[model samples]
Target chain A: DAGITQSPRHKVTETGTPVTLRCHQTENHRYMYWYRQDPGHGLRLIHYSYGVKDTDKGEVSDGYSVSRSKTEDFLLTLESATSSQTSVYFCAISDFGSGGPYEQYFGPGTRLTVT
Target chain B: SQQGEEDPQALSIQEGENATMNCSYKTSINNLQWYRQNSGRGLVHLILIRSNEREKHSGRLRVTLDTSKKSSSLLITASRAADTASYFCATSGEQFYFGTGTSLTVIP
Candidate 1:
């Protein structure tokens, strides 16, 4: 599906450095989300955007921030990357008005490494 | 902080054999979904069973959800080499929570 796409498929950054990962969706869905996956841990939501300029944090949003300036874009940024932030990041989109079910489509995922 | 947890951390079976994975959750949910991920990639949605539904089928995939037990099971019939991947079960509450995932290896 041509719904979602994440930029910088792979990245490496140093601790205390700022990092930003971009997520773009063509479906123009009303909901977008960012998540990180680590070994022994399943995907954990970092943040989500319900509409343009509207966003909310998820479970692991301590060092992360998100911005949604457009309906098709959601950006996840790390104020100061830490070694613990090294993991795979995935972007997903959903239709809150679908009234069908909680079906979310995920992107290819970006691998981030912070040393 | 996933609400659901899957059992049998890993599973391996011969092609054409049946493989089953279990998932348990902590609280009420509107629906349960199964997704498959290949290696370090993103997940692909497989099937979704609502709280009121018991079982659902799609191709060789069969998913059963038991709200009473707050658990779910995924059965893959006629497993194939192409089915080798990690399967995750997720539940929906105020947010969606995904399990740690069950790794399935199918040998040809």
Candidate 2:
């Protein structure tokens, strides 16, 4: 789990409801990422943060937003959950100087089901 | 837009045998990384090979990267049942992209 924690390990929510996933890391890594894994799609990056208050969209950023107000915490928000968004979410951390580029340490995933 | 795609969606091999998986990317990358995930768990970092390096080894795992071909291969020697998992390759450039994965089943 790499000193990283994701809250609400499992959740069941209705479609159209808002949902938020939290990723907290004690490693204080400069880079944080949110990814979703599905049966056939593998893992898709939803968003990433390079530093506090600095964030960027990944390939699958639609319907999701992210915020990094503190160095140790990165939040992913689903403005309105949808059945298509139901999947296992994972959070990962990495520091460019600490290791090499993209030597990520991942947290246990959160299983979300939207009905 | 996944940047990397892993070959052999599923693999089954007996213990003590060897297993190999390959990943091909669409664009140039600074480095390529491999990760393994047990069922119902998050992925764990396995090995990383830089663009400048051609081969890397860690224990029973061997990774080779060919920058010219924009591809990489992960080979596990003397496989064990405990090595059964899904392996994914990720490419890093201006952004990171991950392939679907190859499910490896090491039979005892």
Give the runs in model 2 whose Cα sits over 4 Å from its true position: A98-100
DockQ, 0 to 1 scale, candidate 1: 0.65
- lDDT per residue as tens, model 2, B1-108: 756999999999999999999999988777899999999998899998888899999999999999999999999999999999999999986467889999999999
CAPRI tier of model 1: medium
TM value for model 2: 0.97
The local distance difference test score of model 2 is: 0.92
Docking class of 2: medium
Model 2, A1-115: lDDT tens per residue? 6799999899999999999999999997999999999888888899999999999999899999999999999999999999999999999998784334868899998999999
> Candidate 2 i-RMS (Å)?
2.1
Tell me how candidate 1 scores on lDDT: 0.90
